[model samples]
Target chain A: MRLSNLADYAVVTMSAAARHCGGGRTSAAELAAETGLPVPTVQKVVSKLSAAGLLRSVRGAGGGLQLARPAAAITLADIVEAVEGPIALTACIDGDECAVDHTCSVKPHWPAVNAALRGALAGIPLTQLSKAAPREPNPSGISA
Target chain B: MRLSNLADYAVVTMSAAARHCGGGRTSAAELAAETGLPVPTVQKVVSKLSAAGLLRSVRGAGGGLQLARPAAAITLADIVEAVEGPIALTACIDGDECAVDHTCSVKPHWPAVNAALRGALAGIPLTQLSKAAPREPNPSGISA
Candidate 1:
């Protein structure tokens, strides 16, 4: 499974939002500048996030966008599902139809896998993630 | 993140392989017939699984494929990576460089997310999955 580039940008932009929560609106253009992401890309991410109810957008001067709810309430899974969609390890894991949808012997175990995946994602909330992180570009850079 | 359809096929086909394991080398044709998957698609899944060391293959009249190791030892993640390359939430999750790779603050978190995701996947071994499942297809049509 691969996360689309859009999901990555969404997380980055959301973190940017969290950093500005209650401070005032942050424009997608400014977020793009701060993160070095393309303005159009960040714009799309902001729009999608706003559509997902993760962000509340406002228009007019000094108006932009910010988190709709507390950062603590937003989980990575929520953002992912909003930017992406329901996480499915395999379509048959939760889909209504597949070759073995009815007569498959190993179908039940998939939901467990899916649930575990969701739980892992849900464990990470935007509140925790929005914290100012060290400038390290990769966690592995810390050197075990 | 979206799962490649190939990975889904691999899981579904492997389940079929594990099911017909005791019956001797199961051919891709047989898997396709049993699972109602396209023959070519099933063939690709089997070949990929074999290449990934998940399945052992033989040639000749009775030649076919069987699990390389007990299903218990294999996790869904292993199967997924075998078919899809890797489970990465972002381009740089593997420590690769992106255009804006140099200035991101949350690069540290990406790896944590990756690790968390991998850990969740690794926790689910096929052994547990196979055992939790009955040897036969369930009576009620679970999927739509």
Candidate 2:
């Protein structure tokens, strides 16, 4: 299965946001430029992320968006879900009654599979994803 | 991101195949009927799955498809990858040169995220997916 383009863009947008951590709040226009994503798409992502509580927004002069929590506290699952609802691989798992067949036997097991997939995404933190070079030693020896 | 429809259909088709495990080979037409997926779609899925060695095809009269190995040995990763190449969450991780911007600093960390997502899919065996109710004891207690 593949991620939708919107979801992919969300991750990219979030990565750009994480990179700006501690640098200062970033506006949607700035994020769009950083990610090279369309301005409208970036705004949509920012709105969704903000509503999901992953991002905090301040309006008015010099106001911008920032991560609501530390990057390390946010997971890919959160970013993905913010854009695409729960990280369900199948509609059946999301509680949409299967329209294919009433007696479909495979329906029952989808939840566990969905859980396993979500768990995997949850294991990854934005800190790990934002790090440019996790393996290389810090040039400044600041121990990031 | 969402799994492409093809990938989701592939899982449904394979699960249908797994249900017929000991009952003998099943043709693509039968699978189409069983899954209520279009015949052409089922055929396409069958061809890819066969090429990936997840399904073995027998030609000529009485010819059909069978799992290449026991259902327990097959994993969700195998089914998904068969229909949708690698289970990479991001195109950047797929080795495509990022077209967005050269200065995109978050590119490098995607591989780890991709790996985590794939690893999650890999952890789920087809047997788990094909089973209708994993927690319930079989009335026959035949040990599926």
Candidate 3:
């Protein structure tokens, strides 16, 4: 029903990283300021992405994080899975042995639904995320 | 990433209702037994389905529920929506804005993904659900 905020932050934080891709490792604090993300949250996002292998981290001075793979190769579904787990649209979709697992005829169809959803999410490459760079507001206080 | 149990119960209970489509109305108790759902859960499903105009419910002795519309016209999407509001893989797909709403560049594409998912779900008609009812297993311990 809702994307966890972690997933949203991952995309935003990753976009910030993409902007500084060739500038060597970028610090989490620097990314937070660039993307206007809270420091703690940005750090958490960095840690998760790092652990998920979507990002690789460096240590000591001149250290930070960068995408583990090219943006075009990563998908939104990957971000979602990094934040959450396998998409299980319904408990029975995986054929988990519950009392009514096999009895409910509708359960079989859920796997298909979950697949369709996953496919849709994966259809979007992360390169698309950086296509439209965040723009500054117009003088009237509206997004340009 | 999961279908609420309520939706599961609704789908199960509705399938049972379809099983006896021409055999007159079936009580919640009968459906519960047929589908192995909890009695109160079946009752709640009946109420939600009725409120959503998917089921016609009658009270008193010899009164129960029937599909409000023909099975051919109903889709899994309808039942899903009845129990879970709208089928949104993520809150962003539902157009609910949060603190970081303006900063993300990928938010616009999520709605397209949502539409694709909706299209997939809508493709499955409930009549197909009935016709493709899962068969009971054989004693050989193999799914039929």
Docking class of 3: acceptable
**lDDT tens readout by residue for model 3, B1-144:** 566778877877787888777888888999888888789989999999999999999999889889898887888778888988877756755656656535666665555666666677777777777756443333233211
Pairs with steric clashes in candidate 3: none
Candidate number achieving the greatest DockQ relative to the actual structure: 1
iRMSD for each candidate structure, in the order shown: 4.8, 7.6, 6.8
**What is the C-alpha lDDT profile of model 2 across B33-128, one tens digit per residue?**
888888998898889999999999999999999999999999888888888898776676666766576465556555555666676677778887
lDDT of 1 by residue, B75-133 (tens): 87788889887677777756677778436656656666666677777776766555644
Best by lDDT: 2
Chain A TM-scores, all candidates? 0.84, 0.86, 0.82
Overall lDDT per candidate, in order of appearance:
0.76, 0.77, 0.75
TM-score of each: 0.86, 0.82, 0.83
Candidate 3 lDDT at A64 equals 78
Per-prediction CA RMSD (Å): 4.6, 6.2, 6.6
**DockQ (C-alpha) of model 3?**
0.31
Candidate 1, residue B53: the lDDT equals 89
* Candidate 1: segments with Cα more than 4 A from true spot: A93-96, A99-102, A132-144, B131-144
Better of 2 and 3 by lDDT: 2
